[model samples]
Target: MGLAVIDKSLFRFDGVRQRMGLLALLSLLQALCIVGQAHGLARGLVEIWKLHAVSTLVGPAIEFLAFYALRHFCDVAKQRISSKYGKYVAGQIRPQLQEKIFRLGPQALASRGTGSTVTMLIDGLDQVKSYIEILLPKMTDMMIISLVILVGVWWQDWVSGLILLLMYPLIIFFMVILGLAARDRSNKQYAQFNILNTKFVDSILGLPTLKMLGVDKEYEGEIYSVSERFRKRTIDVLKVAMTSTFALDWFTTLGIAIMAVFLGLRLVNGTMPLFPAMFALIMAPDYFLPVRQFGDNYHATLDGKNALHDIMSFIDSPETPQDTETKWEGWKADSELKLEGIDFAYPVGSKPAGDDTQSVASHSVAMNAVEQQRENEDDKKSDDSSESKDDSKTDSKSRRHRGRGKKDAKPIEADADGKAVAAQALTQPDALHHVSMDFKGYGKIAVIGKSGAGKSTLVNLLAGFNTPHAGSIELDGNRLENFNVAAWQRHISYIPQTPYIFSGSIADNIRFYVSDASNDDVNAAAHEAGLDEWLGELTDGLDTLIGEGNRGISGGQAQRIALARVLLDKSREVLLFDEPTAHLDIETEYDLKKTLLPIMENHLVILATHRLHWLANVDQVLVLDEGQVVESGTPKELIGAGGPLDHLIGEMGGNQIDQYLN
Candidate 1:
């Protein structure tokens, strides 16, 4: 809308300052050429009007042609400079964004949907590149070229200059109004675009299930509705954009027309000479050219401005500090990972002070939804309950509990059999509260909790995707601030519920972690993962292509590929599974469990699951409630002990399963 809205952060890019300066210089020189062309053309026309010989017009004609060509040459050079720099800046920003997202880990992915992240990486960067390309030269032209041309017109004739001067503010005033309108609409359009992308990607990923459930038609209709909304938003933005373009053109055209009328009247009245008057008339359009060009592209650049802000905000965002300097050997049989009084909370806000960074809100959409839902439910319960005094006391207690630091924090009161009472609701400030635990050697431990009980939060902290606000973690007696050390993570293999299978052959996917793994080793690992029969069934064996756009594999097969990767990489001595079989059928889970248990041997396996049967294979069970450890012991000690684990087992029908099996 105005120069004030232009991103000053653009100057921070390498060579941007130098390139912009060069563009300004070029624009200045080009403005001089424009004046020369106008003067020479006017002289040539006057000579022709006086019935001069063709030979007399040669000099002025030559002068006009030379300046005209030179002016356009400068224009081309400026464009090339701006465009090349735009691409260079885009190239520079892409990898920085990728690296930041990579360092942030799966927590970043969960916070930012897979669809939105991909769109930002691809389409958003492209928009920024286009914005840079169009903005720089246009800016220089408006600042330098327009001013110089205006001075030249005033030198030719003051009246025309005054008319141009009056029109400039009017044009700008209208432009600002229209630009503001367009900007608001464009923002809404961009938001709708992101929503559409997320929903589309989510639908595509779940298309198989939709088809199987015979609800594919209904889901298709939902996508159609989303697409229609996006289309309408886009059209609204386009309408504003068109209106802006028309206003710029109308005002600039009117100014040139008014100047022509005045110049013609003066010439007819014999009060003005033909040369100066004609020159002013010739230069009138050139004076308004830059402003019109900039105004025209202003709407086009709004999306880019939004995207650049998003990217810059994300890049500037605070990340959990990594202890890269810490020296630690790989995990060993006797190595122990201990946590003392750990506490964590999701970041309160995504944006830093004074910055309108969309990345935070985009990333935290799902998390905020979950938190809001919890708060709403809590409020609903409070309203429905007749025990108003008890509710008030509970609220007061929660407030007091939140005020205390983890050091001063005491464990929530426990019931009989050492099972912890329900702690504060997860909607409280902290996701994890005064949590403490220890993992030693190759012991297998399962962390069990209901949804929102901080199971994923704990795993993320252990994997170094998150940092504890209050805690001391020690590995092998080496005091550590967080588990984000590269040396430690190098030995850890994490498998989520839906392990991503990259678009490649089965062998290539298996060799992901250990790239140099041989075919024989890949085969052995695949066999170990119980994929040998499947691989044998395929004529291409391990070389058969899978993943997106290739042959589709079952969920079980994808899990097998993930296991094969871990097995092929002998260096990974720690396996972190966050419900790897949660999506699988019962029969498939049993088969995968058989393959998984053997691989879990001689490794520190931390499994977070809702499946109670896993307790039989684990060395210890930790029951978490409201972000704190409620009860923990060997499966045998807690199964019939009327503890949290036992209660959870009964609620989930695990006791019935156990009885039926026995």
Candidate 2:
């Protein structure tokens, strides 16, 4: 059971093998000292029984004390070795795990939830450190010290050694059974812990919303329910842990008691000498000492073992291949970016590759899906003759409704009101299916779509935050895999609906992209972003702190700060905006747009938005519906062509907004 929990990856850490060897040597020395100390005490007792002189007693007593001290000295050495090495291994893994998380990005973490990720970064690593510190020395002791002590006992009296050996298997058998139970319970407890963390963090983030909706108490009750489940799981684990400790202690104590009876019987029969009998009796407890201590700590280290597996699995998960060799001089005025046959799908679930059960389940599901698809195709073939006339009409309508230049595009569907409504929900298999687009030179391009029409998903793909499962991306005529290319991403800036305002001064936030920007540069960038008026109202101006636990700012103000970051970093010539004005009021949106329009000049901009008014400002417009581009042309060409763009504008009340502005 002790060896089963020891992960092979544990040994992969630097100095782990060397430290294990050192601990083994120390355990052996400690074992020898135990035997020597026991022999000395037995010798002193045997001498006292013989009525030896006081001077004769002095030598045996000194020998016993010296070996006893040396045994403890070995223990101290082992502790120090394991302690320092455990901390070192943890230190090495921390940065690697953090870097992996950053590289994976938020799209990958969305399934895991915020609280769970935070717990893994903080509490999970601590558990791994504890597991290492405890497991290493204890495992070495059980392997070396226990065997050495057993051999010592056998040399003294084979009868007592035989009794201890017979009891060893029984102790291990019971330990294994209980250890498995403890492990199962511990897994549940850990899963529940992750759930609790996720829920807690979500609740905290949505606290204000809950209060406004007057449903804070309802969510509070839900949180209490999750907390109670976590508490019950914890108690169940502790129960199994206590039972394991008790069972180990019981069997070991019984073994020692039985060994004492045998030793006494042999002594009475006059078969064994007094010195050897006493030595075996003294060594009996030490024989079971390692096994007992290991069982005691087995439950404690289970959490760490589970934590290590999770951390290792997360770091080892597959990531999109980053392009390293492609060297293009950044985005230029005449540069072009093109994508063809780009496809992407969210993974079914966040199951790690190492999980055998999940792997088998996923394989079975995939096979079933394939079989079902084949069955459906067979059924369709059989019904083709009966539905021939209806299919002909459907195909004719499909050809008429298909967008120009689309490859095998599905016809856009319309409702009774004659509005194009092909919005695809996120639960579908494909987020963006067979999506292809082309951009040349520096210009503003607006991608308009309804909710769940893959607007943000498309933007994320372009920004390299999401990777397509199948796609060919070409940049300046250089064929590429995905936009995860560092050279490409380095030249792009992403601004979501709500820009993150990390705790710092306004100046520091402005210098986020270019950290070493001078005070004058930061002020100039802020002015360009239209933050000069806001700064003038503040007492400390650019030095005023904001973000978490500080003065709060409006959504428009945060957007301006994000623009300031872009203005400060002139090197990033491409900008990807995902509904950047979706959360702001109309007035704030208008003001921010006035500030943002000039910044879009002389740079390639891809803006994904539901606000159709942006079409008036953009040179080209692409209307997406159900993960496919249903319309693409200059605004002057597509606006009133009675196509998907006209349908979308009618549905979103774009004409009314235009009237209000006019």
Candidate 3:
């Protein structure tokens, strides 16, 4: 509500304070021009009242017009200075903010919804620019121009000066009160705007899923509801802005009217001359002009102030720690990774404890409701067994409490006596904890776990997408502080369940990791990834455009493209697959595996999956439950021993060899 305090930060921006000083000087000069114009006009009018010749008034009238022109020239100069500087500052901030966002990575971006981040970068910066451009000149004028005009009026006629001066505090009092109301309302409106943006983006992204479930109309209604709420909030802010404008206008007009009445009486009684009375009357309005303008522009600055705060907060957020100085040659066939007492948890969404948190929470609830409704409709259409399986997975994931509460809920442990007992107090709720493992000269090591059993978390940690809170990782006998090192990431190819197809030609997307790859190299990689036949079908072959807004490729084709990217980049010898085939149909999955298995022969592979069939291909198996490694060994050994892997194989509908054969 106290905008003045918040707005002070604008001065700290580079060149803003210096720009303010120059604008203030210009405002002072403009104020003098204003007084000269008023004086000239008053003289012309007084001469006319005395029944003087028209020729006699020409000089004074010309003087008035000249001063009026000069005053506007100053205004233009001030605007030009402020606007260019504002744009410069905006340009500087945007890139720095973007770089910070990139450094924070996808996990951070997910925590702060994509819609909100996009809005802050685009609309938010635009608002701040507008605020800076307008605020600097207006603020300078209010401080300097008003005082100059008031002094001029006092010099012409003291009584009129006293009356006009008395009105200043009264006008400001009402402005402050209304300004505070406007600020509060505008803040709420801005927050609502963020919600509307987030919901719109989410709805658009999920439109395909909504249509499939036949609940697109329900989501549309939800969007409309959010839009309506934003509209109402906007109206509330406008009402306060309008009231402030009205108050400032009323008080200034009242003060001018009083000054006019007093000067008329003095002139009638011969206590004041015609020239002085007219001059005083003409200058009264100019005295209040700057203050009135400031009040009118108050609402415009509110958004800018809020946006600056948001941008600053994002820039200050803690980034994932990286040891930039560490040098390692690269991953190799004999390279070994030893993770000792590894622990990790998804970071919680830390919202400020005020209206911001409440607003985001409310929007989150609405979004969740929409998602829940869609899920329910999907459930109705799904088979009973599939629904039961999905429900079980959901329960398991919920127990992990990823990004849920304030503290990390440590999973209870079992003692030697097999009694359930509390584990050591953990600082945060962990997605993976005490996950010690060793991988040397990896052929194919399969990390098997149900949903919420920390499979993806472990993969993310390995790929440097996440950093462990407490752990030591030694790669190739060198003590590694964290996995997110640039040198380490360069040697890894991460293939997720759904691979991202960047907007470009087929060859370009395939050659993403190896930008310098030749056409021959791309063709060879595509052939290996099983995309050669698909490319032949296209008119442009390797050059065929794909991705958003281009030719829509099939899901199988997208996966192949991701594989092609990995294949083209020969520097990357380490492959990390996080259930790349989980979403494919059984036939498609089987076909892709035929292409995938052959490529894994020489590379060090760490594949996280729930599919039982992949176990046959993996040389070693690591079974995880509740973030801990429960059992690990060769598939034949685990099966012969009849332990955790055997039980999991039964849960996955028996041995996959029989299913494959059938």
Candidate 4:
């Protein structure tokens, strides 16, 4: 609609400008051939009307046929050139978009939504390709061919030329008005389509849960409703587009009728010759042809224009701040990490005036409740945080977990009417607030917390998936701005409750962290992880293929595969476990602990869990309540001191003492 959406930078895509120039030249030549064909046909018709000799008509007929063939050849060449250039541009953009998506990481993708991102990469790019191919040659033809035909008509008869020229602006004025309407409607339709796609994908991904809950039928009905809404929106946009096309056709046809009438009147009055009147009549439609076709194709290109806008917006999005200049060696046995006054809060949506803090606080509370519920549910399964598996589902949930650590001072505020206001506070909260901790050398430290107590948030921050908004971190006596630094992450192994099983052989999954590991090394790591018995039972043994959409494996087996990965990568000295055995049954947990205890020796291990039995093996315990460390000491000292750790053990039924003894 508006030329602004065309994006001038698109012309710079590879060889677009060069190809467009070439096409324009071809179009100009084609315009000349069109004029020649019209003139020759007019001359032949005039000769026939005059009863001229057959030989005279033969020359004009041959000339007309030759020009017609030339015009079509030029058209074919323009199409071929434009099509190649379109494909090249699309190929170039697809990879760049994918790379950007990767660099932006799960945080960005979660904000953008998975369905929308996938649609942009696949369907959006395709629409852009089609737009580029059709628009280039069409634009050039409108610019070059239309003017040439107009001048040719003027040469034959000025009256016809003047009439066609005046109608140009009239057609354009109507096109712009109708084009804007179509653009508005089309944009709305596209937005609805994206919403439909997002809902569909979310439903499909959660289909298993829906079926388990017996709500699959309800979800299906909702999907159908959304689809119907999208269909209706599409029809609305088409109606406007078709109306615009009809208007353009009407104006062009009216202009042609007027030209023919004028020419006939002039010829009857003996002011114009037969050949000239006929030639002008023939060229009138050709003169207006380019603009009319452009108007018709305008709606077709609207999707591409919007798609280009979406792609450019994504490419231009600001990336999370990362420090790339830091230099340091990997973590070691004596490496120390300290956090001082660390503060963080989940980012909130834009709010209206006078409601900013209140809105954010309420949203934060709602989000935290939802996150706690999800984490509790997920803890019942496996705690795998791999991008290929859980990132799509958990990324959004995790964002809500990033909130201020301070407990809400005013849990409920009252309005003048004595009715409780949902959220009425000025202070903002952080997921971790003024929290300080010290970890040094090789030993096991357990971080214990209830749901929404910032356990996962701390893990995410340490894994470099999130950055603290305040305070500083020190690693091995070197002060660091953030944990996202590459030098530090390379030496760390993070194993969640559920480890992701990649689509590959059992041996390949074992060697994930160390791709060049020999068969002996793989077998040794698997033995350490207690996977030897399972592998022995398999017909293919180490060569067994398993993962999503492949051979099914138990949660315990997946955790063992993850353990093997850590065992294979001996260079890693720092291990972070977020409830690695939370999803396992009691027997499986006991077995996993036997394997994990040996690996925890002589390594800096930080295990966050609700399982109180872990306290028996840990050297130091850091107890967290509402996101702050309430107690820190050796497990023996904190166990029966009636402190936060003691309270937590009591809440878990106090039977953990016997379990720990066993």
Local accuracy of candidate 1 as per-residue lDDT tens digits, 358-424 = 4433233223233334456566432211100100111211333454454454332223311110121
TM-score against native, each model: 0.77, 0.74, 0.76, 0.71
Top candidate (TM-score): 1
- Regions of candidate 1 where Cα sits further than 4 Å from its true position: 36-73, 109-119, 180-239, 349-407, 410-429, 498-569, 584-598, 612-617, 636-643, 655-662
Supply every candidate's count of residue pairs whose N, Cα or C atoms clash at under 3 angstroms.
Answer: 1, 0, 3, 8
Q: What does the lDDT come to for candidate 1? A: 0.76
Residue by residue across 401-499, what tens digits does model 3's lDDT show?
A: 434432343222223211111122133355566788898885899999765467766786788766665667888867765676778888889887667
The worst-scoring run of ten residues by lDDT in candidate 2 lies at: 384-393
Q: Which runs of model 2 end up more than 4 angstroms from their true locations?
A: 43-61, 202-228, 267-274, 350-428, 444-450, 469-472, 495-569, 579-601, 609-625, 630-662
TM-score between candidate 2 and the true structure? 0.74
